[model samples]
Structure formats: C-alpha cells, structure tokens
Target: MYPAADTATLLIDGKWLEADDGATFPVTAPATGELIGRAADAGAAETDRAIDAAAAAFGPWSAETAYARADVLRRAHDLMLERAEDLAVLMSTEQGKPLKAARNEVRYAADFLAWFAEEAKRVHGRTIPSNRRGHRFQVLKQPVGVVAGITPWNYPMSMITRKVAPAVAAGCTIVLKPAEQTPLCAVAVLALLEEAGLPPGVANLVTTARPEPVGERLLADPRVRKLTFTGSTEVGMRLAAGAAATMKRVSMELGGHAPMIVFDDADPVHAAKGATLAKFLNTGQACISPNRIYVQRGVVEAFTEALVARTATLSAGPGTSPGVSIGPLVDDAALTKVQRQVDDAVERGARLVLGGTRLTEDGLDRGCFFAPTVLADIDETMLIYREETFGPVAAVIPFDTEEEVVARANDTAYGLASYLYTRDLGRATRVSEALRFGIVGVNDINPTGAQAPFGGVGVSGLGREGGVEGLDEYLDVKLIGTAL
Candidate 1:
C-alpha cells in the first residue's frame, strides 16, 4: 500500500499537464508519516485552465444524450470493480484507513457510478397542465453548464464519485479539485474515466496544495454554473458565499457533530456495539460519525461499560495491518485537536473512562495515532459537547427522558447525521422525528448509501449529494409553453 503508483500531473483539457511553475507537494501516509508520492501543486492559473476546459467541453458533452453519458459512467463503474484491488491499495496508502475499509470504500465509490449510470437514463422531462385550451406546457431538466467539485480526503474515491457521478449523469462537464492531502486518488479516478471513453475535458482535475486561491477562482468564475463541495463548515460557508456572488448553484456537504441517543429500552450491549461502530469507523474521522453519545440514566452505566470494553478492542495501527479496525489520524493537527478536545472534556468534569492520551509506544511513535477513547459524564459545559472531535473518541452524556435527550441532541449548529437505538417502536419513531438532522438512523448506525440523500440542515451546509436529488443539484429547470 505504501509504494502505490504515484500520479504527479494535472488533468487539464484532454492532457495530463505539469504545473508551469513546477511546484509539487509531498503526500505522506498518516499511518507512518512515510512519503508515498508527490503531486503537482496547482494554483490559480491551473484552476483557470481547468474551468475553461470544462466550459468548452460542456457544449458537446451536454448535447450528448443521457444514455451516452450513462454509458461512459457505466463503463467507469465496471473498470473500478475490475481494478478494485489497485484502487483500494492506493486508497489505503494515501487515506490511512484499513485496507479492508479502503476496499469497501472503493466498492462504495464504484456503486455511486453504477447508481447514477442507471439513474441517468431516467432524467425525464414532464408535460405540464396548460391553462389555455390552445396552448401546451412542458417542464424540462437541463444540465447546468460547467461544474466545479471540491472533495475532501476522507473517503476520497467515494466523495468524488458521489459528486462527479451525479453531475456527469446530469450531462454536466466538471473540474474537480481533490483534497491536496490525497490527490493521487483523484488522479486515478480521472484515469478510469478516461479509459471509460469519457471525452477529454469533460472531466478536468486540478490537484493543488493551496485551495483558497484555486477555490476562489472556481467560485468566482461566471462560467462555472454549479459548485459542489464536501469539507469543513467554515470553508464550505466561505465557498458558498463566493458562489452566491456569481449566482452559481452551490451544494455543500459540510461538517457534522452527529448525536447517537440510546434509550433504556434498548439492549445496552447491542446499543453499545452500534455506538462503537458508528463512532469509531474510519477512526471516527467521518463527517457522519457520532461525535456525541447520549444514554438514558437507567442504561447509562451498562452502556458505558459495554462501550468502553468494545472500544478498547479497537487496535489503532497502520491501515495495511491485519485485523486493524482503527487507523491513525490523517495528520498531526488532527491528533493535536483530538488531544485538546479530550483534555478539555476531562478538565471540565467529564470522566475519562479510558484512553485519553496519544499513542506513542508499540511502534506507534511515528504515526498520528490516538487511542480509541471513551469518556463518561459528558455535559453541555464541556468543549467536546459542541465541537466535532473528528477522532476515535466517544463522550457519553446521561439523559433523564426522551424529551430531554431530543432537546440535547438537537442543540448543535451542525445537523448532518444522527442515530437512535430503542426497543420501543413508538419511542424510536418519536425520537427520530424529533431530531433536527438531515439524516436519522433509527436502530441502525449505518444508513447512508449511493442511493440515499446525503446532506444536512442549518450551518451543516446546503443541498443534498446522493439520490435523484443529487442530480437535481447539477441541473436547471425550465418551463416551456407553446401555442397550439
């Protein structure tokens, strides 16, 4: 996984071009801080070329029938599944998730392409009712011109597919900027699309270490009709604001401080297992990871015991290692932030039930490894209660009633995903409906998919990313009336 084939060029127009300034950035594995590859550090000029190429490609690309676009996407999907091992290896090397998890992500990424490939054929317009007897009315869904997609490092392959697949399926050309930390994956994805018979310039890639300047250009460009981004809340807001200045259609899948609530009626062990999986998957780096855990007072003790015990079993190591469920934080900053959050939580009266320190022993000294942490007695007064830790730390807060827990869970500026576990169906229904998140998992920790609508409410950012609704984000509607 460490010596994956390194890609070091930008995909502008139909060609792979090196930056004119010859700037490059080193890509190191968070698992060991080992330099795996180098990527071209694109800047404003490269971004401008990518946008211009996407705009030029949009005309012929969008003019193609939906079925044609679907054919290319379908071919890419097959190629991904065919070359799954290579992609998974590269993903593990670059992203620091387990090889198994990387494999799963590769499949999930391919699944998006497959989902949208079939969905593209169903992009249908409709006949509308006419008020006048001698007139006809029609509604049409057309591709929004050029699309600029900015993706994050976590689940790099899947995020790109989740974004680019829909935009392509909707017959829109795109310029993609993958997270600088993991640009090789994006380069690999564009290569697959190229082999899938996608016309050159239909999908351009701009890999850059400096995103602000490149992002500013993408958002400010009048030719880029749509902007889709998946990253931090602060960055997403700034990009959304810039897009608004150009009146661009913007969809942002930003940060989340997801809540997982367990009722007393639930089996404490079962709820704990669900909570462990939801909280620690991808080492708790996922946007939808349950950052906050709420348990009813009657079940809190058993839940905490089970959760702590289960979390202790998660081994944080190189993602390439065997049976390793948890992996290193993506960088030193992430490790520092997780450490700060845990320290703040403990200082504010929360109990560190287990693991509150960074991992430096047992050959973990070189990596950004934090132990799988579990804290109890978390309260609203604690900093961890409000911030998205984005690490493998679970802070448990005990609640008295369903009403109180729901109120506590909804108290967040971010609302991307939430979860509830209860044996009582009525309680589950009532609680699920009460949560103010864009997504709720009732008795289910993993609810999102290629076909599901993935996004958020409030400052969690704008628009949906998956399902038919995702395609709509890359499209514009028009009503046409003709006199008979």
Candidate 2:
C-alpha cells in the first residue's frame, strides 16, 4: 500500500477528503511500472458535492474586483515557482516526460498563470453608438460560471494550468478532473493554489478511474456553466454531445496529425534537425507534434539520412535519468499502438532506415520504451501516414512540388498544427497561408507560448487556449441599452 505522503486525496469545498466510499486507485510510474502512489477514486456523489461547492462559491468569487482576482493568480504563480522542483519530479515520475522537459512544463504552466493574472484586469468592454437620442449602448464582459475542466495525461501540469488559470482569472470557480493516469501532478498543483489563498470552493479536484459517475455528472449538471476538455477527438465528440443536452458552453482541444514539410530550398541538415526535435518532443505524444514529414524529392535522401543520424543520438529511459533525450510512452497501451503502426508501415514496403523496434536499455525492460524510428518511401496507403502516430516514429514522404506538398499536408481530417521550412520568403508565406491548420510554424518547430492563440481548425477541436482569445473562452459578453 502507498503511504499517505505519496497519495493524493480529494480537494472538495476547501476540505481534503476521501471518497464517500473510501475508494482509491493506485498511481503507477510509467517508466518502471511501479506503484508510485494512490489517488482518491471519487464517483458521481462526490462530483455532485464538488459542483455544489463551486456553485455556492461562484457568486462571491465573481463579485470580487478583477484586480483582486489578479492578485490571487499572481500569488499562485509565485508559489508554483517555489515548488517547481517537486512538481517537475512528480511529473517526470508519473507522466514519463524528461526531467528537464518536465521542469520547463512547470515554468510554462506558471507563465500561463502570470499571463492570465494581467489579462484579468484587461477584460475590456466596448461602447456602441445608439440611434435614439438620450440613449446609450454598451457591451460588457463577465465570467462564465462554474467550469468543468477535463484534461489529458500528456503535459498534465500545463494542460491543467492552461484551463484553470484562465477560469480563475476570469472570476469563475472550477471543478477539475485530471486524467486518471496522472492525478498526482494535478494534486500538487491544487496544493499550490490553496497555499496561494484561493478561497474555498473556488477550485476543486476529483480523481477517478471511471469517468461515468464523475465526468458524466459534471457534464450533465446545469450548475456547470462551461465545459473545457483536452483529449482524443472520439471522446471529445461524445462529451460535446452530452454537454449540448444542457446547452452549456464548451471548448475543446482535440487530437491532431500535424504535418512537417521540408522544402528543397532549405538547408537539409538544419531542417532535419528541427524536424527531429519536433517529432520526438515528449516522445512524439504531443497533439501538435509532426506526424507526417514531407520532404521534397531532390533532398529526400539527404533529409532522411540526417534525420536518422540525429534521432539515433537520442537516449531512451526513465525520465528522471540524467541525459534522457526520450522517455517511455505513457503506458503499455500507448506502446502497443505505436508498435502496431510501425509494424504495419514496415510490412507495407516502407524502408526503416534506423530504429524500428522497442527499446529495453538502462533498466527500461519494465517500462514502455520505443526506439526513435525513421521510415522512408511511404505512400498514402500507409497507416502511419494516415493515422496519428503518437510515438517517436517519423514517416518521410517525397513531394515533387510545393503545390503537391500542400495538398498532401492538408489531406487529413485533423488540422491542429503544421510546419514548413524554406529560404524563399515568398514560398514560405504562400505555403503558411495555404496550410489548413490552426497553428503554423515557418522555420520554427515550437511556436507555442502564453502570448499566442493555440488551437486547431477542423476535427482538432474548437476554441483557443492562450492570449486574449484564451480569456475570452471563459467569459460571456452582454449588451445593455440605457436611456439618459
């Protein structure tokens, strides 16, 4: 049994309590498959209690001045920095991201808190001219009450912060349901908010293996005015349908099969390096990660060779290990999925230039580790080219022209993110506009920040999650007409 110190209890109505049935589930480290701790396994009744708490606290929290809310967020940001090391270790242990990357994720999460803190006071309204004399018209902005945030296991800390920070800054109370595999990180974050003096019921957390009772109740409850989620497109569609029954506001950041195009005009070595970094970041588990690589025909061979050389240098092991360039996948299921995709591709005439198997080095036999692989001669019929490969596998397809590459890149139903590299400014500008994605990067692999709008078009999901647009997701606009 995990000791109390390693476990995460529920936070409901400002009180740390266990489930009504005293139910709990084990939290295992993906890197070692060892039991790290346990989390409260809350059900519908507990979710209802948390919702009631948020409903009760919403009035007072929303009534406070925007600056007052900003102060609380700023305090939380400072506390996050104070606890960054502990949080980073926790994330690395459970979520299987590299330690350095985990620490950076904490900083990124804190940045969101800081950004939203300033944005709270800047939620400005507009004045409109009225046709009638002695009449004035204006639009006002206010928080959307009681939010239910359902976040994924990948990037656990930042995902929660991205949703929670904006909700809190906009003067809304929230009930957060983190992914079952990684609730410990969420608990760590909740502790910081409490220490930062967030009022009781303003923020609550419930962890459970089953989403039925907890997640279902959260979506169905009318008191929960807005629902935000980051997960697969299949699950998002189901949640959206359910939330529609109550007509609650909904924002979702779903799955993606992002394409990375390397033009012949760009430096082969440079493009290859950037592509490798983008494809292997977070072990290629990110939604915006490059899944399909389109290299121009003239440089396909050179690009593929350089990509293999760079990828071969990446080390795979437990995230806590010192020089781990790649960490284990989140679980056995993820590992199996990646394996099946790679196997299918190799069987279908694709050449594996470098790694094409699972890794079991450095005590990684017990963990879910996959080798960084590169495949070439892939056509549209390959599964890795069509589906989203959420692993460290790069499938490079050759393109004859810019128009052909654009068409190939936009062939998928998902359009979350895409990237292109070319020295020709005209070509870069033209392709950037033509790509059907929410976020595009030209000569830049990582374009995300707290200051930009991050979201996708098509099946990638609805709404944005950063910048002024991010704050707007948690607020509602009202128009008023007054006679003077």
Candidate 3:
C-alpha cells in the first residue's frame, strides 16, 4: 500500500509507459528503508520519446487561447486541493518530511496552479509608439516552446508543480524529469493534470536514478527550448553551461546558505521559535534553511535558552508517526554529511549546547536519524558555518553592532535568503539593504509563496520561480510592426 500498483511506470504522451528496456529503480522509505516500490528507469531512448512528445504537443498547446490554458490549470488546482491529503501522505512516505509539513506542501503546491491559472489570462501584449509615421508597433508574449524540467528529491511535488504549472500556463508544453527518489508523488500529480483535461503529449514525465545521462537528452535536443531545474549549485552550473550550447532559456534555482540575525530589540522567545521552525523545517533539507544564526550579544543567552528548549520538544522518527516533528534524513549520504559537519564544528571549538549524536537507539537505527543539534560560538572558519549543513543542525554566532553583523552575513558566496528580527525599524531596513541575499524577511521566516517572486542572486542561480517573473521565464517576447 505504499503507492499505487502501477507506480513502476513513466508518464509519457498522456499514457503510463514502461521503459523500453524494461529497466526499473527501487524507491524505499527513508524512515524504515522499506521498499515502497520501483519506478520505471528511463534511459536515453525513453528520454528522447518524452522530448519528442513535448515537441509534438507544443504547437497545439501554445496555440490555445489563454483562457483555454487557464481552464485546464484551474481544474488541476481544484483537483490538487481535493486530493491534498493523499499527496501529502505520498510525500511524507517517500521524502521523509512530517505528515503535517507534507500537507502544507501540497496546499502550497496547489497555489502555483491557481496563481498561474489567473496569470495566464493576463499575458497581455503592449503597444509601442513607432518612430515611422503610419506604422504601429506592438510586443507580444508567446510561449518559449517545449520545456524540460529536472527537480530534486527534497521538494518532490511543489518543485515539479512550480515549474510545470507556469510553463503550462504560459502555453508551453513540458517534459519533466522529477528526482528519482520521489517519482511516485510526481506520478500522482501528473495524474491530476491529465484528468483535468491536459491533452496527450502536452505534459510528459520520465523517472530514472541516473539523471545525468538521461537528463542530458533534454538539453541535447534543440526542440527543448528551455530547461528549468532546482538542485545543488554545482549541478546547476553544469546544466546552465550545457543549455548554452543550444541557446535554450534556462531557469536554475540552486543552493542557498541563508542567514538569520536576532537583535536585542526583538522578542527572544519569538525569534527562537522562528529559528526552530526555519532551521528544522524539512529536517533542514530545504535550500532556504537558515544555515547561520547571528545573535546580538545583549540577548544571545536568552535566545539560546529558548531555542534549545524549542528544539528539545521535537521528536525524530518516521514522518507518519504521531507527535513526530522531525523525521529521518533522506538517506545515509545525508546522514554522513551532517555527521561530518558536526564533527568538524566540534573540532573547531564550538560548544554543542544540545543533542549532537545519531539516534540509533529507540528503533531508529535502521533509518538515517540524527538528533537535532545546536552549536554555539561558531565562527565562519567552521564547515557548519561555511558550507550548507542540510540537516537538523543550527549554528549560532554572537555579534555586537549592526554593521558587524551585516558584514558577517553578507560575507558568503551564495546569496539566496536572509532573515532579521528587530523591532528597530531603522536597523532592520539598514541591515536588509546591506545583506546580499535576494529574499530578505524582516521579521517573518516564511517569506516564500506562490504569488511572490522566489529566487536568489549570485551563485544561488538565475531566474525566479513564482509571481509574474516566473510566468515570464517560459515566455519569449516578439516585437510586431504593421503599416497602417
């Protein structure tokens, strides 16, 4: 009962398909390492078929009226809400986020569909004054054509929908390759789109463990005019470089090392609670998780105490278990990375203020389990502060003045999201301006939404995922001039 009986198949050309080579890959529960099921392991041959399908469907899909596209997206949005619980369970079972978080993710994911549905109707063209007499000039927004998307396992559903919805809304056809680990959820979501009147070949999906060679097929074909991806920064750079050969438009949402600064004027307890939510959300696997937490010296002790207390309450276990706020890491590799960071932090003289060991007792030995950890007096030299600790670990560094903290926070190569909690509006505004991140939350930790432009600057990658900017990524502009 882990997933549907036909989970081990691909979605190509509006039909569930088996890999031509009959290859399959195993998908296991992150909590128990139990075999959920296998998914079709699409190779280059199957990959080409999906791309061909998207190319075939692009003409019809892009030619449809904006209202027609909106109708299909709106129906998909309603169906997403109707099956929210089921999708949540599928995400929790495969991706290891808590069921509660999973429920929230699907709801959030559905918003993209709804937002883009309305946005589709508003893809208005603008008229331009022509320099020549008796001539009219206008600019048109048209779909960029066949789009290829590759998403990571951390955000199985939302990432896929965020890319697919806008592309579909913009009148472009899509051939999506979701992360291999979480393909079932992709299958379930694609089913909704198909049921909601998405025509055959308008949207296609292929799953495989080896995304490199298979995903390269998407970039290799000139018919795929755009490539949208969300993953590590290193891979994003590679994909961007690959797409350049064919001059395909690429949207890359890559790595992030977010910073959260807690000033003395802010409520220590409130900031601590927000830190807990932001740090341990999705077991810190999110790209926008706060990697470094800066505390003003005046209230460092109070904030630390409250943060430890809040973290202590979170129980790590299977995502579906009752009262479990935290769940296993996605796999052993993630666990190893967390362990390495913690070890390095300890070796660098940081104090472990709370739990830091692996939770092997109490029936969690089989899965990848690490206790939620906190390290204080962390410096920028340490790996926990320098690199992304994509686990349930928080790094705390104490600071004094606003200028000093702003410099410290902006002293990173990757600039994605940053947060600051301060009642002093002047300080908040000043520090936010100084920070080099794309998205800054003055007092709120939850800064991203379906209607907001979610993206980053610098090595964090290019393009936005939400809002009107996201819709524009799948569209190309054309200038038309006519003699009157």
Candidate 4:
C-alpha cells in the first residue's frame, strides 16, 4: 500500500512550512477519480521564498568539496532503493502508471542519483596553453548558483531525480516546481532527500495551482542562474523567452512525436511486440513514446495483424489492478485530447483496426481510461499523423522505400527520439545515422539508461539530461589566467 498523501507543508529553506497564505489544492487520483489529498498551494510569495532560500544556500553549497556532495547523494540513492516499493505504489496512485512500470521508474530514478553521485567526483577541468610567454591559462568548472527545475507529471519520480540529482551533485542548489497534478510524489521524494541528510535550503519544493506566480517568477528571476524544464514544447518556448531576460542558463527536454520504422526484413512478431511495448508504456503518456509507425509496404499487412493481436492482449484499468498493462490518463483533459485525435484521424479516412473507444466497462467508468488503439492507412494529412498523440494510440503508415520512410519521419518539428527495427547491419547503421533525432533505438525500443545522454533537437528543446553531460548542465566554466 502507498503511504498517505503529504499535506503538511512545502519544503523551503530545509524546513517544512505551510504557504504564507495557507492556500491548498486537492490532488485526485486519475485511476478512480478519488481525492488523493490536498497539497500546499504555494503562490508568488512562497515561490520567492524558495528562490531566496536556494540563492542563500548556493554559496556554501557550491563551496563544498565534491566528495561531500557525493556522500549525500549516495545516501539519498540508498534511501530511495530501500523505499522503492512504497515509492512505486505512490507513483502508481498519483501518476497513473502501472505498478510494475512505476517500480521500474523508481529504480531508474535511483540510478540517476547514483550515477550523478559518482559523476560528482569526476567533473574535471584542464590547463590551456598560453599564447604568450610568461603567461599561464587554466580552466575550472564550478556550480552555476541556484537553479529552477520545472518537471512534468508524466514521469513524476524520475523527472525530479533526473534534475535534482545532477544539480546537487554539481554543487548547485535548486527550487523544484513539480507538476501540480502529482505533487504528492514530489513531496515524498523531498522527504526522502531530507532523511538522506541534504542540507537546509540546498533543495526546495514549491507546488502551486497557478503557474504565473511560481513558474513565471522563477523564469524571470535573476537569482536563478539556470532553468531546467521537462514538459511541452509550448511551455518550454515561453520559459526560454522569459529566461533570456535574465540571461540564465536553460536546459529543456520538450515534446516528441517519435517515429518507429519497421523494415520488411524484421520479424513481424518481434517488431509488433516492440512497438506495443513502446507505444503503450505508461499508457502512452511518455514524451518519447512512439507516436507514429512506418511499416515497409511489403510487410505492412502482416505487421498490422501482429500489432492488433498484441494490442488486444493488453489489459486497461486502474494501475493498482492486477494484470493491467495500461492505466488511466492523467486527467479529463488528456482523455479528451486522445479522443479528439482519434476522431480526427477517423474522419480523415484512417481506419481503426483494434481498440479505439474509451473503456467505461468493468468498473472503469469513473476513471480516465482509454483503450489501446491502433489506426491503419494513416497519412500525413491526418491530425494524428501530424501531432503528438500523448496517449495509447498508434497510427501506422505504410512506406515503400527506406528513403521515403526516412524523409517522412524527419519531417516532424520535434526530434526527441526515433526507432528502427532491422537485422541488416548495413541498414541499421545507415538508417540510425539518417534519423534526425537526439536518440535512436535500432532493434530496441528502450534506449534510455544512466550511462547514455538523453535529450532532443529542433522543437523538442535544447541540452542533454543524462550521463556526463547532464551534470554539466548545472555547471559553468571559468578561465583563470596568470602572467609572470
């Protein structure tokens, strides 16, 4: 069972205190439409307080030895693993992912903390050659003061860990603004950090119902030296513009309409299984979820049949339910968006082969549950074909040649991730290189790990989030010159 929702207070300056005005908002479970709990609703004043706390703590925190920071992160990682089961259940309740998937997310989140913990000691700088005699040059890497982390609800636990771990490991303090829909998980995570011995004011959390007061203030504040956000492209663009006024460093992991290309040489069953897992994971709420499928014309019919069979095997219900593969959408708005996209696709002449309607039967009427949907004959003109569905809906488009498929896949404004399935070594190397995405999974659906860099290009946003590069996001370079 999951722990009770944390309704005490927001974490600021290393203390748990109520918002200045004591305002609160209700957090409801998407699975059952039940009230999870009420969370502190921090506004402008609370946001400013968190920022001030992070700024005040930044100097001392950044001055600490890398080993010191690494110790704290390691403790936090151990604590998270010890509490993984509870955290996973909490994630399933608040974030609406299946229990199994939620458990994996917690494990994945812990890996980031551990990875960054070791990486803390390895942040290096080098000596530069001087142009003139009697002159010496050296480069040093240091923390970038206070940071504002804005994360989405899709991967609540992992997103927080991904940003917070690296920021702390890099010796930077942070004010985290978690998605309001899943603030309880963020609260739980903050509690773990505190228990793991994070110093006061080094990490803070402010949850607000309104973005203008909290989110906007962080973006516009000069005290926040960096802004790292993971959410929609629309919001990322707005944050980028606002952050520019203060000349703050920015790292954004925005939206993605990832394409999965299945070649004729690939086994139909294996390709279908991979596509199913990729598309339906987390009920397809992932930013990097495969939104579009391009099958070679010669194998399109067989692949479609296999995909329909695989999709039909998935069980959609509450996340806590046994044997449920797909879970509810985050809210009514998400449900409506998915429904609208499917309807538009059908209206544009795409055929729904598998599941297409909302699941209201079997005690799921109150929740935001959508069936695992598959659409065939999808063309570029269809709304589903052009947009990120962000749901458990896959639109399959047939292509006659590899060149044609590559061109169509790269046509999107978003370039976060792409996937290709083939046994041909030459084709794998060629197509993987041709794909204009930050990450490409050839013959594999899951490409993310602690050792690899994760980010995107084009409208998908800027900067990397994992691996050695992720830690660098919170650091700045300083050049020292000496003349004798």
Clashes by residue pair, model 2: none
Scored against the true structure, residue 127 in model 4 reaches a CA lDDT of 94
lDDT accuracy of residue 180 in candidate 3 = 85
Q: List, residue by residue over 95-192, the lDDT tens digit for candidate 4.
A: 88999999999999999989999999999999999999999999999999999999999999999999999999999999999999999899888888
Q: Per-residue lDDT of 401-439 in model 1, one digit per residue for the tens?
A: 888889999998999999998888888888888899999
The sequence of per-residue lDDT tens digits that candidate 2 reaches over residues 1-484 is: 1125443478888988788887899999998999988888999999999999999999999999999999988999998999899899999999999999999999999999999999999999999999999999999999999999999999999999899999999999999999999999989888888888899999999989898788899888999999999999999999999999999998989999999999999999999999999999999999999999999999998999899999999989889999998998988888899989888988999998878888886688899999999999888888998899899999999999989999989999998999999999999999999999999999999999998999999999999999999999999999999999
Which candidate achieves the best lDDT against the true structure?
A: 2
Error of 2 at 20 (Å): 0.9
Q: Against the hidden true structure, what lDDT does model 1 obtain?
A: 0.90
Give stretches of model 1 more than 4 Å off. Answer: 1-7
Each model's backbone clash number: 0, 0, 0, 0
Stretches of candidate 2 above 4 Å error?
1-8
User: Predicted candidate 2: what Cα RMSD to the true structure?
Assistant: 1.7
Overall lDDT per candidate, in order of appearance: 0.90, 0.92, 0.91, 0.91
User: What C-alpha lDDT does candidate 2 achieve relative to the native structure?
Assistant: 0.92
| C-alpha positional error of residue 125 in candidate 4 after TM-score superposition, expressed in Å | 0.8
